[model samples]
Target: MHKFHKSIFREYDIRGVVNETLYPTDAYHIGRRYGTLVDSRLGGKKICVGYDGRLSSPALAAELIRGLKDSGMDVVELGLGPTPMVYYSVFELDADGGIMITGSHNPPSHNGFKIMLGKDSLFGAEIAGLEKITEYKEGFGSVTKLNIKTRYIMRLLQDCIIEDGYKIGWDPGNGASGEIVQKLCKALPGKHFLINEKIDGKFPAHHPDPTIPENLEQLAELVSKNKLDVGFAFDGDGDRLGIIDEKGDIIWGDQLLAILAQEVLAENPGATIIADVKSSRLFEEEVSRLGGKPLIWKTGHSLIKTKMKEMQAPLAGEMSAHIFFADKYYGFDDGIYAALRFLNIMQNSGKTASELLRALPRYYSSLEYRIPCKESDKLKIISDLKNALKVKKASFSDIDGVRVNYEDSWWLLRASNTGNYLVARFEAKTEKKLAELEATLSGFLAEYGYFLEV
Candidate 1:
């Protein structure tokens, strides 16, 4: 007999290293517990289950379904696909809730569960509540199969009028996205020059995440070599987007937010735009210049979604490329949908991608440099830095992390929600100003035995 442990259930979702802390028995228990959670809240007996491209995902999803079925909740297995595909199935099929077996952009050895309830992301106390049900788990239900990916592909294709003659570049990054990119492209009106199109959990082509500049190399090459219009890359589970322009410029998420913001404002003037605290300050400025309200809040996806609903914002995005669009589509992070929306924007403007971006005022910034710390010490390090930097002369904001605002530059240090790392970004009006900000923070960090590194 296996007993459910409390340590595995975490703040955002359930995660652990495969075969070490995570196992089929544990997954079965989680499914039962989660199924019971569903039964209590929604009273619907059906749940849509899905997974990613990892070798363990299929087995984990199967065991998860077994538990759900055992708990008397009807299980609709959608097999391997991106997280957004699972969300689409849950909504289209009218599932009570859904659980996606994906590690997201985590390391290869890690796997986790992302659960959705009644069309909302479950997190914080809601995610923690799973343990209470696991203590006395018994409810299990019926299981079935549905090839919903075809419907999903057709829907994406139908939603847009793509240019069939255009040559576009794609970097799937060997994640779950490759499994369906070709199928979905049939509806797309362009030729795809794909890089890392194979679905390999080992991530031989580079990590699936496109947010990092290094990961954009291959896709950038393809864009320049073939003279493609645009390039797009998917994260491990394909919820986040990474975009490269025809000029091979690796657009930051905030920059992309600005690009999409142009299209969004054209449709609805004076709408609210929400972005994470780590986002570029330029985004907020542009929002105002374009006649939209800008709101900066915390960084997590769950938090952003909740804030979006609370503020009734039409569009939201994070530095990680998790875009939520309540403007015309479901307000969830769908990288594929985001990519198409980018194209739609380009088509409407009749502007080349580079020309569109060139319209924005230029500013230089550093990549989000991660400072590694032990899981136990990360929080303390933040606290120490916060106390040390708090002075009568300095202005700071703590929306998520500490954002020190100087006269000519700013630096933000926030702990990552999904990993044991500190995310830092610095920007300035000039190279000299940026160096001053970096030097100041570097001194503070050095005293604590950790220094900022690019």
Candidate 2:
């Protein structure tokens, strides 16, 4: 029996700092356990594996592959590519399951595995179940190399409606998508300026997370210097995206979603659209105004994708830039595909990115804040905050967290599923109500012996 570190098995994925909390041994056990589980469910146990450009990934992947073969599962290796490419490989190769060795947007020192069983995302309790296995059955399984990047790129271009000539800047942040972006830019129309096209594990350019405004500075400058019509940025693994307008100003996830909604609704009226709880209320209003059904769901790429399938949503997005489209493609979060769709809207409408956004209503909002709290205490803190809100008889929705609705403002407090922290946001029509909401949230956290730096 192989022992596994409890911390490495997170709610969404298996993640930890390399060589410390997570090691090659942990990866091997994970592969062994997951392989055994999948082998029992499928007549054929062919699993596809891919890794990002991390310093430790190649070694970890080798060890994981050995364990998979030992546990009786055939392996289809997709050498090196983004996490989404691995997901595509599962579909392209018709494998029983897939695993992507990636750190996502985490720092270079951290790494993890994103898993899928068949087409279902392995998360939450399913990820935790890997640790309880005490039996190991070995069978003869094969290993093969499958490179689907050419086919994947073709698929990305299949549904793209490239219309007009516009200068665009693209930044891959030297993550796994770097080389793919180079290939994509060469095929797509327009004057494309590419940056960070070399995959470097150290991320010598900047942290590969596009959600942070600071990370987009390089792309923004490129847009300004080149007089580009728009700019696009991708997170480390290429499942998340960031956009910059013509003026070099950042177009946040909510605003980008709203703009894309306009294009989608124009073609398919009354289609259902989904967004996470952290999205702006104005985005929902805009969707309704465009004759689409708007839904607010929990934050997490896997959770959003599952909800989209359940509701038959043609489109869905999170405030963190995880956009899913079932309209003309597989319902999965793909940053490059989303960027292409945004280009289609711009070309078809003949409108600037800034002009398209000016049509939507705006509100005063706070940057997403992550406050430190022990993993053991985060859920309790959220529970205590919810109890306090209930006692106050506050109007709120507890679907994922406590999203309290006030007369002129709203605030959300939720425990992060991926990390040991409480995530929060506040929005209001006026600065006064914004401050009041912040104060109110601060008071609730104080009651739980935790403090939020608003």
Candidate 3:
């Protein structure tokens, strides 16, 4: 029996540093366990497996497939592509379950698995149960290799109807989305300028996380140099997205959500639109103004997806750039698909990206701040903070974390589900109020001996 580290099984997925917290043997065990779960519990036989551009992904995927075959589970092998392609295969191929071997926005040295069983992601208690599996079934199972790239691209193209030939800039940041971006651009009606389109596990051009403003410098430069209408960037596994306007100013995730919501609301009035708790107040206000019901839910992608299903929401997004559209397509976060949807909106509106997004009310907002904390202490700190807030009679929502609401400002502090850190953000109508809110949050953390610097 392999003794898997508890830390690797996160709230959302299985992830860890390669050869350290995670290994080939671990991947094999995971496959054996997951295959058994799929067959015995879900009564499923076919599973689709895909990998990202990470160097360690192929070997891990190969071992995983072997273990799955050993457990008598037939595998549809999606050779190499983004995480969303694996998700697409589940629906397009009508498979029982799926798994994408990716590290997402994490560094090159890390790798992990994002899993689905019957279209819904395996998370929370389901993920926790993987550690307890001790038995594996042995039998012969077949493997079918599949190339889903062209079909996936065609699906995206068919969904979007772009008539305008707007000059667009794209930066895949040398991640899994590189090839897909290149192919999609060729088919779309636009003057496309793309950088770092080569799929490289090393991520030579920059870190693949577009959420970090530093990583988007190259894309901004590309947009500015060409005087393009807009720019887009993708993360490591091409699940999250980042955007730059004509002036090379970044359209943050909440702002982008506001733009997308306008189009969605027009099509489906009074439809529930979900945003993560970390999203700005402007998003909620905009959705309400557009006659759409706004819901602020938990932060993780899987959690949000489940909530979307429960509420039957047409559109949903996070501050981290994970946008899901159930309006006209499958409700999975796909960077390429989102980029096209935005392009279609731009084309139909005959407006520049800046003009389309300029109407969103602005606030003095801080970028997401991550503070390192021990995995063991993360939950405890949050619990203590909540208790402290309760005693103070603070106006806050504890949906995912504690988001303290004020008359003209709000701030959020939550433990990151994917890492050993506490993530925080602040927004206010004025800079002084933003500073005051930061101070208030810092003072609260000080009680727990976690001093924060604004």
Candidate 4:
């Protein structure tokens, strides 16, 4: 009997509330199954493992390592660090695959694994297959402890090109990236202010999600009080970034992507730049105007990275702040690396963050609004809604979700791949049009026993 909590296996990664949905036993099984797949099919023997600052991470990692070793997969334990460091470890050590034990932006009570095999992220059907494999092959495999912190930091700072003096603020939200952020601040040539730099799994200051406005409050306050040039915040695992400007203005993920795109497109014209369907149309248009091809794809880090490689795109980002850069670095989402790249862009431009973002044409848009729905019902609602739109002869793109294109704006309604919720966002030329679209979406939702709250 090889039973496991099915809910933990999401579209992107495995995540669950610690000790409840996820247990040490689950980690062991995951390692056993994943290791078997690697050894039997992928023909890989060496694997790298790393964990975040979450309370249960250490125990989970230990069990996972034991299982991996038992399955005859040599384990390279990378110890405590952000998720990206683990990604880097795989590449640096030339390991066959890597597994990062991180909850990502989830709450402190949550913990899980983000997996990679030979530069490929495992999700969807690949993750699901782990449950079906009942055979657990046992053998004695070696475990090696490696301190990769110094090497990781040096690699991150390698491409950093910043002008001598500029003050900036940073908040790690007491997540896994704290120690690295502290070290990075010391190495850089500028006045660096940081908060919540201690790697406390409890996340004592606030929740680690930077996508939510409230979580950026501490960084915003610090930027304002110190009259700093800008501020950056990281999610729980440090794979995503949240930025605030010198004036304490929140620069949403798309806006940050747009800014970065300008610089990247300048160097490599006609390059394809990808963004998630949840991003602003303005960003897509900006990419086109900057002599680059803009592609709107599904919202997931794994999906985006895969697309980036396929399109040979130099850059790609999502509204959730998972920015991938193949311009100078590997195509992986690393908030710390993105921050350094952004700083380099700012330094070269010799302009304030406000000036850079404000110059872009403004469009009124709504934040991601979630409508509660049962997991089973969520996709069915979307399917029904798609049918309704088709009957009405609506112009929309169903690439990932249904993004209906209007004359002056667009609206997107997509079932969340990671959870049991329908995520929506709308944009229009004016508030009146926005209101009308909201009503239109609400009408569709009402028929499915759901309502839009925003």
Candidate number with greatest lDDT: 4
Give per-residue CA lDDT, model 2, range 273-294, as digits (tens).
Answer: 9999999888888999999999
lDDT of 3 by residue, 1-454 (tens): 8898768999999999999999999989999999999988878889999999999999999999998998899999988899999998999988999999999999999999999988999999999898999988777788999888999999988888886568989999899998999999889886999999999999999999999999999999998899999999999999999999998899988888888998899999999999998899999889999999999999999998999999999899999999999988889999888888898888888888988777788799999988877878888988988998899999999988799999899999999988878999999999999999889878877766677766
How does model 2 fare in lDDT?
0.89
Q: Please state the error at residue 18 of candidate 4 in Å.
A: 1.6
What's the lDDT for all of these models?
0.83, 0.89, 0.91, 0.91
Each model's number of backbone clashes? 12, 0, 0, 0
> What TM-score quantifies how close candidate 2 is to the native fold?
0.97
lDDT of 3 at 381: 84
Where is model 4 more than 4 Å wrong at Cα? none
**On a 0 to 1 TM-score scale, where does candidate 1 land against the true structure?**
0.95
lDDT of 1 by residue, 1-454 (tens): 4565545677678888888878878888888888778777877778888899887888888888888887788888888889999888877888788999999987788898988997888898998877666353356467788888888887666557556566888888999888678777766777888878788989998977788889999999999999999899999998899988999887788888888998888888999999998888888878999999999999988899889999888899999999888887778888888888888888888887787778775666777888876677777777876776774556888888798876656899888776777888898888888887788877877776777874
Q: Candidate 4: which pairs clash?
A: none
The parts of candidate 1 lying over 4 Å away from their true place are 1-7, 134-137, 388-390
Q: Residue 167 deviation, candidate 1, in Å?
A: 1.4
| Candidate order, lDDT descending | 4, 3, 2, 1
User: Is candidate 1 or 4 superior in TM-score?
Assistant: 4
TM-score of each: 0.95, 0.97, 0.98, 0.98
Model 2 ranges off by over 4 Å = none
Cand. 3 TM to true fold? 0.98
